[model samples]
Target: MNAFPPAQALSGRRPAVAVWPWPIALGLLTVFGLLSALLGQHGIWLALSWAALSLPLIVTVICLVRAWSRPSDKGGRS
Candidate 1:
């Protein structure tokens, strides 16, 4: 064990900004994508729909990759 607990700048106790933004943004993108796809058959709406839908998936992939690549800091078993 270390002499002192690892210090964190943000430390989960207080965030620099509210946590709702990302989730709300992702949900809005998904809703917009679905609506555009359902309402518009062709043209810009379809493009927008595809783009909107893809953003959340891309973000998810990025987050997952980052999470998987990093080692856990909260494990200690002897």
Candidate 2:
């Protein structure tokens, strides 16, 4: 017999939360900002809008890279 109980019994499972809203909102903002910049007349407004749109994207990329570089718990599990 195994010393450890079955994995399923060790932890209670819960429904996952939907986490795509932020990314979706950011993507929509970027698309709208770019479209406005291309079709509208204000040059400074366009630059500012594009810069604002880039902030979330940059943050997301940094988070993804950090997560990818961190050590996983693969082999540590029995």
Best candidate, lDDT-wise?
Answer: 1
Q: For candidate 2, give the lDDT of residue 18.
A: 66
Pairs clashing within candidate 2: none
Q: How does each model score on lDDT? A: 0.73, 0.63
Q: What lDDT is obtained when candidate 1 is compared to the true structure?
A: 0.73
lDDT of 2 by residue, 1-78 (tens): 113334543454423446887778778778877777777748887886788678778877887776566556232122
Query: Against the hidden reference, what TM-scores do the models get?
Result: 0.67, 0.52
Task: List where candidate 1 sits over 4 angstroms from the true fold.
Answer: 1-6, 9-17, 72-78
Q: Where is the poorest 10-residue window by lDDT in model 1?
A: 1-10
Model 1 C-alpha lDDT per residue in residues 1-78, reported as the tens digit of each score: 122234443253432446688999999999999999899978999999999999999998987776566566453210
